[model samples]
Target: MKRSWWKIACVVLLVYTVVGGLLLPVPALRQLQETIRNLYFHVCMWMAMMTVFTVSVVNSIKYLRQLDLRRDIQASEYATTGVVLGLLGYATGIIWASYTWADPNNPAYASFGSIVREPKLIGTAMALLIYFAYFVLRSSITDMDKKARVSAVYNIFAYAMLFPSIWIIPRLVPSLHPGQEGNPALNVNDVDARMRLVFYPAIIGWTLLAVWITSLNVRLAFIKEKNWLNAH
Candidate 1:
C-alpha cells in the first residue's frame, strides 16, 4: 500500500481536477472566457511532458555514466512517454486555440494557418520534431551498445535544444501564446488564485500518470531483454 500510494493519489487528484476544473469559477479575462478551463488539461499536460522529458534525459545521463542497458531501457521508455504527453499537450493547445484565437470572420483553414504560424506553436513543433529525430536516430543503429550510446548522447542534445526551441526563442519573439514575459501558467499575476487549486494538482496528477506509464514500459522492456541483460 505504501509503495502504491502515489498511484492512488494520481487517480484521486485527476478526478478532482476534472470535476473542479469544469465546475470552478475562473477569472473573467479578456478573450479567454470559459475556455480558460483548458488550463487544467492543456497547460498541465505540457508541464507533465517537461517533467517526463527531464526524467528521460536524467536516465540517459545515467546510462552514459554507468553503461547499464537497464538504464538505457529506462531512458527510452521515459522518452516515449514524454513524446506521448507532448502530443497530447499539442492537441489540447490547438483545440483551445481554435476556439479562442480563431477569427470569427476567417474560414477554419485560414485561421489554422495563422495559428500554425504563431511563434510559440512553431517553437513547440520544433521541440517535438527534435525528439522524434531522437527515435529515428536510435532505430538507424543495429548494434545494441552503439545504439544506446549514440541515442543517449542525442537525448542529452535534444534536452538542451528544448530550452532554445520551446523556452528561449518563443519568449524572444512576439507570440499569441501566454507567458511571453515569464513562465506560462506560473504567473500569479495572470492565473487566478482559485484556479491554482485544480491547476497545481492537475500538474501532479498528469506527471504521476506519466511516471507510472513509464515504469510499466521499463519493466516490460526489462522482461523482454532479460536474457541479453543477464549476459551483459
Candidate 2:
C-alpha cells in the first residue's frame, strides 16, 4: 500500500509534536507545566498567519507589476486565509492569556485587563484592522479591473505597515508578552530542547496547512468567477 506524501508527513509531524511535548524532563515540565503544551498551537497559528500574509503581499506585488486579474485573485484568497488564521491565532492567545493571567485562583496568573493592554496585543489588533480594510476597499469598487488594481496597491501599503505594526512597535514598548523588551522567551537558550523539538515542527505543519487552505480558496474563487462569466 502506497501512502500519500502529505498524509505521511502530517502523521509524522502530529506524532512528533505530541510525543516530544509529553516527554519533557521534570524540571522543564515544572517550569511550563501543562501551559507549555499550548505552545504547539499558539506558536504554530501565528507562524501560519504570517506565512499566509506574506504570500498575500507578494501576490499583490505581482499583480501591480503585471496588472493581471489572476494574481489579484490569488492575493485576495491569500489575504482571506491570512485574516482567518490571524483571528484564530489571536483567539488562542487570548485563551492562553486567560489561563496564565486572568485566573486569580492560579498563583502564577495576573489580570486579564493587563494582558489586554499589552503592546503586542494592541499592535496585533491594529494589523488585523489594516488587512480588514483591504477587503472593504476591494468590495467598494464595482469595476473589476479597477477593483483589482486598487486592491493591489492597497495590499502593498498594508504589507508595509504589517512589520512595524506587528513586530517592531510591540518589541519597543515595555510588555508582558514574551520576546519584548529583552524578554528571555525570544532566546533559543530560553526554550528547552524538548520544547524546541515540538515548536519547530509545529511551525512547519501549520504553515503547510495554511498554504493548502489558501490554494483551495484560490481554486474556488477561480471556479466562481468562471461560472459568473459564463452566466453573463
Candidate 3:
C-alpha cells in the first residue's frame, strides 16, 4: 500500500511522543513520580479510542438511514479498531496501576484483586463488551441486509451505553481513577502545560493510526464482497 502524507505524519508524531514522553520533564507529583509518563500513552489510547468509536456510531447512523452495506462495513471496522485500542489502553492502565497503586511497600489496595474491579476499568470493559456483542450479532445471521439493519440499531444502543459507563457510573462511585473534580484528561487545571503538548499530539497520532488500520480492513472487506457477488 502506498503511504499517504497523513500516514507519514502519524509515524513522525508517534516517534516524537516516544522520545519526548520519555525525556520531557513532567510534574513531580508525590507517589506518581516517573510512572506519570503513562499519561501520554495510556490516556492517549483511551481518548483516541473514544474518538474512533464516536465515528463508528456516526457511520452506524448513516447505515441505518440509507441501509448501505458500505456504511455498515465502515462502522464495523472502526468499532473493532476502537475496541483494539481500548483493550490496549486497559492493559497499559493495569501495568501503570500495579506499579503505582500496588507498590508492595505502600499498597493502594489490600489485595491485588481489588485492582481488577476499578470503576474506570469496569466502565471501559462494559463499553468493549457491548461492541464485541455487535460483532457477534453480525456473525449470527445469514441475511446481509437484515443483519446490517439490526446490528446498526444495536450500534446506536451501544453508543448510548458508552457515555454513561465511562463518565456517569464511574463518577457515582469512589474511584481511585481520579475524576472527582472533573475528568483529568479534559481538565485544563489537572494536566500540566508540558504534558499537554505531547498528549494532544499523541491522541491525534494514535487515532490516525487506528483509522488507518480500519481503512485496511474496509478495503479487504470491499474486495471480498465484490468477489462473493461475482461468484453468486
Give me the candidate number with maximum TM-score: 1
Q: Residue 21 lDDT in model 2?
A: 61
Candidate ranking (TM-score, best to worst): 1, 3, 2
Report how far off residue 96 is in candidate 1 (Å): 0.7
For all candidates in order, the CA lDDT equals 0.87, 0.76, 0.84
Per-prediction TM-score? 0.95, 0.84, 0.90
Error of 3 at 207 (Å): 1.0
Candidate 2: residue 215 Cα off by (Å): 0.8
lDDT of 1 at 19: 96
lDDT of 3 by residue, 60-104 (tens): 999888877888889988999989999999889988988777858
Please give the clash total of every predicted structure, in order.
0, 0, 0
Per-residue lDDT of model 1, residues 29-111, tens digit only: 78888999999999988788878888889999999999999998998898889789888988999889888988879888888
* lDDT for model 1: 0.87
The Cα error of candidate 1 at residue 223, in Å, is 0.9
By the TM-score metric, which is better: model 2 or model 3? Answer: 3
lDDT measured at residue 146 in model 3 versus the true structure, 0 to 100: 85
Descending-lDDT candidate ranking: 1, 3, 2
RMSD in angstroms, candidate 2?
Answer: 3.7
